[model samples]
Target chain A: MHESPAVRGRRIKKSFGDVVALDGVDLDVAAGQVHGLVGPNGAGKTTLLGLLLGLAVADGGELEILGTPVGRTLAVPDGVAGFVDGPGLYPSLTARQNLSALASLRGYDAGRGVDDALEQVGLTDVADDRIRGFSLGMRQRLGLAAALLTRPRLLVLDEPANGLDPAGKHHVHRVITGLAADGVAVVLSSHRMDDLAALCSEVTVLATGRVVFSGPVTKLAAESGALDYRLLTSDTAAARRVALDTPGIRVPSGGDRVQRPDADVLVVRGAVPAVEELVVRLVRAEVAVRELAPVVAPLEAAFLALTGAVPTDEEVS
Target chain B: MTTTVTPPAVEARPAPVLRGYRFELVKLLSQWRIRVLLLACWIAPAGFVAAVSLQSVLPADTVFGRWMHATGWAGSLVVLDFSRSWALPLLTALVAGDVFAAEDRLGTWRHLLVAVRSPRRIFVSKGLASLTVLLLLVAGLAGSSIAGGLAAVGNHPLVGLDGHLLAPADAAGTVLLSWACVLAPTLAFAAIGLLGSVALGRSTMGLLMPALLAFALQLAQLLPLPVAVRLALPSHAFLAWRGLFTGPAQTGPLFIGLAVSLAWAVVATVAAYHLFLRRDFTDLTYDGSGRRVLVAGALPLAALVLLTFAVVTATTPAKGSGIERAKVEGSLATAYAHLYRMQTRELHRPDVTEAQLRATASCDKGGSRVADQGPGNDWRCVVSWHLPGATAVGTAIYQLDVTADGRYVADGDGPKEVNGYFQVRTSTGDAPNPLWQFDGNVDLLASTSKD
Candidate 1:
């Protein structure tokens, strides 16, 4: 199997006068997979996306997109499509007209294909509506449709799901999944960890323009120091007994203890799958376990630990 | 996890500027504003010529002449007039002002840069599109002027105020070329608007600055100054177009007008290109770009002002007339006797034969000194003659004004001038004579005797 990256960057740095936007970053996105980049505000995730989209060039190190090597003076690559920051849209143009203009520029025979792309983005009904009237989510979808019209091999999207409702997010996720299934590489930068987790099998967490962690999401969860377990039990004593026997487990203390002592409830921390094994063992031991949930959400906990920045309330959601 | 890779069905190719430009043209042409502007381009010159032509035909008492008559080839469009000098510039401003500014007003500059492949490409494409539109707009104005003039005014012998009739061939050539002269100055305005559009990043300033500059140039030309500064201004081109109508038309001013406007356009366009390409537009702060300071603080305005001031002061007359001693009585007696002899011998009556007139004038005043005829300063005079059974009378007028350089004044006020005609009224009861007038101020380049 080929190990070469479809897109790669090493030790990339970008600065705007007195402001350091990106510093000593490394990233690689292989073909046929979706790579999610997540970070808190000012973490330089958008900067990295800018680098990939050819909107900004790194000040140091080498960057590559698809098979094309890039330098600080590199032009936007031929077959790469995506949005950095937010999509640039002609607000006066109708959705279909915008797509058609893009298609015409690319010399594509956009005939009925613009309609098809609109349908794919679930914007067919509003294809004739001017983009000025579109919601943020709808505009995002239209941008996606524009990208799809070019049939790009590498897609770099920044915070694409920020304004999407559940169904809209689902639709976006499905479309991204379908693209990945067709062997298109996607580099998605988002502030929403849940969205990243749902859509990306592999993830990179950046902090201060450097990648703090990059690998499979499951690996990140497993390697995390501790997993939070939410427990529901018919008998509190039985759940406590199971947890006590479980090695490498700690129960919440102080105000963290919210459950009534006579009723069934418990909270504990351990390795994720290990805690799951313990719960199975407890059920086998005939202690009724009603619910199990992670209290220290792995993605959230990882984000806080990696960034070392306090997660805002919005981020926690 | 194992991933499955499938070969893509197709590869995408990059787009070219030609295709991009076509789309741009489509957008520009589809706008209702552009349609209205084009319509105005057609109507304005036609309407101007029609109005002038109607005035010319109604009454001879009105200050109407062949110059007011629309050129024969351009049908109803009046090619020569004071109103067109200002009107054409305004018409140019109406269209050229909005070229790049419209995009800024619509908030499309950033959007276009992103949607297009690059800003450099966008700049070039948009510039070309604007130039194309300007050409079309100028053509429409010129074409309508020609068409309207020919249609509205009947093709008759155009007797100029000087009693010279412009032939069909000469009039056609002059009107066409004159309209073209307007284009040279219009380009300067176009460039100004474009620079404003890019530098200020607002459409209104783009339009306003150019229009204002053109009007400013026109005002500057009116100030007391040398011929050079007057000729250098963009508005001079408007006046340069007047050359086509005048007898023995001088091409020098037209060439100077062309050169000045071309230089202005080139300098402005180059400056605009530099600022547009170098400025960090990512920030998109319109005012903070520093373009205004650079453009406004340039040395050209100061240089032109100082040059004008120095030239005007140095050239204008120090006081009033220095030759005030050459006054009326002595010269008036000689002038009358000389005038009497010339009338008796040369002027003929309706009933008298030419042979009979010669026998009447062997008078001593028949050959008087030239100086005895009149005072140099007197431009207007009345004289009498004898026609068959009636005393024939007429006016022999002279108007003189020295140049700013204190040059001598030249006098020839037979008929036409800028303001109106000075008629030569004869008392003979013949058909009513066509009155001639001196319409403009006269300045002496050199004396006919000295030449």
Candidate 2:
């Protein structure tokens, strides 16, 4: 028999007073799969993540985590672990003490693999320092270390890469990828498009409390409309002229065609097929197209289009 | 991605509540603030005992203050009485009030709830931990006071209420029992503090609100109201230990007081737990708006005040109605007999028996025209007693301050020669008894009729 999905939500709904935080949200993630959630501010990403972790209960609809049905008691399945809206920690306690407290509260032997978990998050050096003095990056890493102590089967992290240095982000990425390899289903929400594209095989995009897109990473790229591209050519004039003559390709105002400010650079905006046609025409016309790349990554371009507005601080948090 | 080896499964336990309780205890004990508070509790009694022992005059206003300088046990009793006013409630509230709100202040509620699985379990664990800390504080303070008293003043027979003498061992037991009695009300205050903490979501407010409320309630007891209304106040239980010091050990008020106090504790704790279980942890911000304050704080207070008024109205009779003439006459006769016997003994006239004194008293309220029956502070009594050498009966006027609770303080204007300490004979051939002396004023409660 096929194993059940690690998480399944059907028409999940939640509201805070008059604000409808999540309306008819449905999501699923199988074991060993890393699913990415992307949305602008106030798109209900945090609300959905909170539901998965049992920090909150949906006002209406079905939610199942690790094969257990969610209830109104705010209790998730045993294996669900992660942080939303920043991790909760005791500032008076040291990093090591915080983890031990969590372990003891969970009825586990605190001495069991606390050190290993600390080392996994690269927090072993400052484990004895009080968390009050810790930087945001350090606190975020410590939160990850706390979650790892439970050996969770399903990880739900909201902006896990927040405030991380490059090395800390690399350590987190490795840990998340390693956990997924061990059949731990990870559902990560982030605004960093590169992190999502690099880590997630499937992505879900939320807009205004509803799922706007859900599929493989490639599908999201395909769904993106015409995106701007930065083109570098040996013959910028020939490339600009070819672009203007093309059916669906248009040289933007700042391109060589308008100002000729940059001798060998051009800017174009068009669909992939039209850009390809331009490239083909340029090569056939001996324009010598050296390089062509979208100005922004497809995931970000699609996210901006899907969200259609800048996110407010409240929604981002 | 590479798969890592899985560790062995840890043994699972069924009792999450016990684990949560243990964790809460660890968290509470680990705080430096709590440790310092307990240390202060253990050490402050010695300084207080030393400071109070140096006073030339006795602290005569409190229950056992008159004898506090005369005996160590009385000194402990004095401390116990003083602490009941505010110190005990504040001590219990200091820890119990912060028990849950500290988690909110530290942003650990969500973490704790997610780990513990049951919010009720978390609530129970926190409450139990707070109770444990409160018990420890009480024990520490009691033990320290007893130790300080023993070291500063030697143990001696305590002067009981109404001129009854308590043996040294009995006095020590009574003092200890009084301290123990205060614990019930202290726990009630703790419950109040816990409720405040859960409702307010801030540690400072939790700590201060219960203490302020208890102080206000204690002040309310001093207001002129029916005896039943006063009895209903939680502070009434703090004075219940006085029953243990009285003759024949009246336990009616003690039992009733304990029941009232425990009922308050149970109600507050249950309400706190109910609120906690239903509260949403996602947003722990306390909205201290006018409407919220009216609903959360003022409504309960208004209800309590109305209930007190209703009880007073239902129980209190019309004017000129509380004290009965027969009861007053009987109690005055008995008290006069007791005091007159002690007086003759102090005057070296032990040959005079209570029967020889033949005390008969007539009492009136405010003035002779006013009926001698209502509960009022102004009361007067005329007593005719036989003096050993006098040819006829001697009449002395006494001013009595009568309380609604059947307690009275009588000031006698007798012979001027008997004002100062005089020679006393305890038994045949005993040389001038010095310790057992008499004052012009006497305090006593009315006698309970056996029928």
Candidate 3:
């Protein structure tokens, strides 16, 4: 094992004057694992990121990075690297120069030079170009390249995949996985549960600065005892009757359905086995299933269940 | 919980400070605003010189006027020095204000702290880098002004504050010294800008506040402070070298100005450093994670500047009767004494004493008085003196004006009181008639006669 609870926070509380941003929150992230921090707007997701970045100090807490305590004079502990809100970059500098500047800032040799880091992030062709000309996706990649220059052992990224295209998101997911495989602990905060589901082995759900649930994503699914399913059918009435007739299943009431107008799909919230049995019964009833998918992850569903609404991308961004 | 100690081989290594600082310095230099500010320091002076030299397009008495007449070039360049007295300070603050503040604006404060473990080195290195840039600018501006003034004005005697002619060498010395004098006070302003940057974590107000304060001080100095108060001000250093153009030079104010400027620079730098050390690192950069950043020592600096100005003004010497007498008599006695000593050594012996000089001397080589001394004698004399030389002695002059308000007075030569008729004799010169005569100190055109 690399260490103890990789990032341990006990009864952490922070406030800006009278406004409580983080209210007595406790979280633990272990090494060799990717932990997702999911929360609604003003629920202290960004505040938690700031603490991880050593950018903000908590009012009351016993916090540690790599088992070493962080106090008043908090320097981003050794082996820690990430963005709280967004990466700070020199706009006039080229993509390569921005990474080089950061490389030098952290005193890292950045051995292969700016070109090498850009190459790793698939930004090599445009590396020499100024950051001012880069698109949002390109800027995100540039931020990633700069962070990688440090070869951080503990990476804290806030919505790292927000502006990333599918390819870029895949690249980030792979890069984060690779860092974790090398024992670099990853703490990522994002509203995109699919990205979190794909990248994190463990997820920490926060609601109003308090941790509602934290553990493996499987544990969150098992603990929630349910999943939201999105089903499409040619014979909607037949599929509905079959789903209703199935044992341990009931048709989601209007109150339980989360309508998706754009997708034209009805979200049926039910127990995991009940929803699973409904899918089987629909097949038996000769209902043509055009689409069958979970609305989102059990963790995301659990996140909404605890917080009572979907977390918009803006909340993390 | 038992803490596990990792073997030496398993422990992670930390980053070095030198590498981090160099990176920071490079980033600072690469900033467009900083580069432009530095470039201006070098280029502005040269541009001013070139423009000034090409001012006159036709033949004229004044060099700038002549250039303008001959070449159709504007005279704007020749007056750069006058304008730069205020402009250079503002320009210096522009770059200095952003020195530490840019990091905060960019959200790199915490990032830098992570890289460099000690805040002290970061503070020192950045402060030094900014100061180096400031010094370079001062040098560039000074060089440009001196060279430009010479090229524009050529070898002709430059105009003085009192409109007297100044020879080329004298003018060069004055301009160069004046430019150098600007540095002492500028250091304080530069430090203030840095202090602002560190506290506010932003450049906009950092640059503006100091320039504004400097302007305010200039205005405050105009209030009813004593001559000593104004003389003691660091701002007086701004006008100190102007005295070099005055006829028969005096350096009292110049030296006083230099000393005061030096004191301000030292005190400001020390205080700025001390505050920087105790300040919370969280305030060094702006994350805006919170509503506001609380700078540890900003109020103290503002207080110090205000207090310094207030104390200086309050205790400033008053220009009363005694002060007026000291200025007038002091200048007069010194000038006369100076000329008297020189002439006495040439005409007679060098060892002549005051008592001997006062004794009655014969016009025809006989030990006889000019007139029989009596209580009612109207021909009474009063003698004052003026000193001489550039190194130590200063130039002064006295005038004998017999106002209608004049009453009976006594003479030092004889024990007699006569109807006052202001007969003035200096330590060296012959006594002027009971009318008005100029010995040396007061410029007839410039002086305001009370009577």
Candidate 4:
């Protein structure tokens, strides 16, 4: 559609004392898109999100939100709204009152958009109940509703899926997707690979305050070239023999990454063609295949490969 | 909030500060604790009035309590004076202490900033909201006190500090004016509470630190500091209105008190505002964590206060001993003359006007070695007064407890056979005498009294 990106942050540098939170990072989000930020702990995900929400100003960077350049002062353009480090909600206020308070603070008429926000987040039932007794999931949902009160063009959230149950998770997912459909740009940080795979078309992987990978979700999954395939067959010995005989396949006798608790299953590692050949050979050998699947999901494997890499012993003091 | 297919026409939005201020006001008013504090401010005074009215001994030890039964104005005055001790400081602290810290406590600074965007807007709005509530708090207590006092006690004359009987109307005026004057010091404390909140970033510290600082300043005020030094302290504004009811300009600390008051308020508020601006809301752990005592920030403020004290003390010399010999003489003789006239009228004796009784006093604090320039309970004055046609002068030794602000309680040592006893014989019955123990203020800080 060639729409101008809703957010463009370049070479952003933010530091707290001597701790380098973010060092020369870059990010972009287009309209009507869900952008996932995936990073390990202390990966500057929250710091980046804080900058997007105007909770902080970048010490050294250019950040444009909704096409307006952010200033040195703590501010983003008016249409940008969100929270980092979990949603900062007032426990003393009711769910509805919290939304109303945000609306009032945002210069909207009181109660003008509160009900819509609550209904959007599926919090209408507990709208009038004080949030002090609310579960973390409920508070997260309420925080999302408060963001909705802004009708933001660009939304930034940190760990939105934290503390959410299945039903609440789906509810929030639906809201995020609906907002993206409505042409809002959303940039949310999550440790959950499945959440990013489900909701995000574009994902940015950060490691040590630098972008290790940034592209489509499909591209992120493809970053890992090798696969750990779990193999099970009616004739296990026969299938193992056929898989061992197959080309371009390594079935490790002393297993590591492909290790499984199931004693009857054989673990193999190779490219997609090698695994396909092993499956075909198993059928040809008349060892009926019961199951053959990647032991770790592609996205998780890709995420771990991209962000979970530990520094060498020599790199540490 | 639905996004429209067509762009809506641009409309002027309210200033972000105004919007935030309105919400902050609503948020503050919505809290049950705030409402309860306000209710306590209003309702607690009535209980005090009732308690004082039911007691026969009267609160004679209090500054304005000796005439609690005589007039409602006395009750109001008692509340006005007593609130200064701790109630007003704590009250201002209770309102402003947590306004900023509560956001940090709740981790809602991000939530609020997402809406307001500018921390400056948040700071100004929250401060304005706190000030508004404080104004309401003071007004509520004042209104309730005046109303409760009048309803509990009858409107009668008030015994001024100078020992003159003030008519009920004028007394009420004086009481209300005193209460109104309390706002300056109240604002100064409120600013300190805000500074504590921003700098400390904890609700408990924000609430208690400003109050503790006020107490510390109050203790400093009592240290026989120079009159300029005393007047420069915000705490002294509480006692500044004492001399106003004497039918002249008794507010000697008026100008300096006001200047110091606004200076403290502005400086504290500005310091708080800067700290707020410097805050980094990058994490949810916002309240008093990750930050320790800012010695760089605090030392300058402390130095400013100390420098103000040093400059004023050095520049404005306190030449004489505490409560000048002339002021003590004038106050003792005036109080004695006024009370004697009343006593003579009740006893059906010839009235001796204040001028007819030529009174003189010689006072000293400590022994002859002491400077006698500051406040102390060690003050002793020998007062002599002559009757219109009496041959001999009557002398009495008076022990005085004088405060740094120049108000004193004097006890006269005289025989029961004279009018110096606790009570005096009148034609109708024994009437309470005002001469034996009397309260007076020596206007040492007054412009005309600089000696």
Task: Please estimate how well model 3 matches the true structure, expressed as its whole-model Cα lDDT.
Answer: 0.58
Q: Please give the distance, in angstroms, between residue A82's alpha carbon in candidate 2 and its true position after superposition.
A: 2.6
- Give candidate 1's TM-score: 0.70
Best-to-worst DockQ order: 4, 3, 2, 1
Better by DockQ, candidate 2 or 1:
2
Clashes of each: 33, 1, 29, 5
Q: Point out where model 2 deviates above 4 Å.
A: A71-73, A228-268, A272-296, A310-317, B1-15, B203-207, B284-451
Q: List the candidate 3 regions with Cα displacement exceeding 4 Å.
A: A1-5, A23-25, A57-60, A110-113, A237-267, A280-287, A310-317, B1-21, B53-80, B83-85, B151-174, B199-203, B221-234, B241-451
**Could you tell me the TM-score of chain A in candidate 1?**
0.84
- Which candidate comes out best when scored by TM-score? 4
Between prediction 1 and prediction 2, the one with superior TM-score is 2
The single-chain TM-score for chain B of candidate 1 is 0.64
TM-score for chain A, prediction 2: 0.91
TM-score for chain A in each prediction: 0.84, 0.91, 0.86, 0.91
Query: How does each model score on lDDT?
Result: 0.59, 0.73, 0.58, 0.77
TM-score-wise, the better of 2 and 3 is 2
Give the docking tier of candidate 3.
acceptable
Q: Rank by lDDT, highest first.
A: 4, 2, 1, 3
Candidate 1 CAPRI classification by DockQ: incorrect
Q: What would the per-residue lDDT of candidate 4 be over residues B1-451, giving only the tens digit for each residue?
A: 1111222212223347877888888888888899998898888887787678657777777787876766777887777888888888988778898888888777777777777766777889999999999988888778777777788777777878877878888887888888878888899889988888887786477678668977898888677766756665777777777777664556546655666777788878887887788777785556663243345245545666677676656655444434666676677667767766776776678888878877667788788998655678888888777888889987777888888778888887665444466666643235467677878887765433423
DockQ of 2: 0.21
Candidate number with greatest lDDT: 4
lDDT of 3 at A298: 72
The residue-by-residue lDDT of candidate 1 on A120-184, one tens digit each, is 99999998887878898998888888878878788888778867878998998999999999889
lDDT tens readout by residue for model 2, A1-317: 98989998888888888988887888999999999999988889988887787777888777778877776656776777788767788777889988998887665668866888899999889989988899888888888888888899998888999999899898899999999999999999999999998899999999889999898998888877788777888977778889999999977665664223555567788899999999899989988877788877888888877778533323222
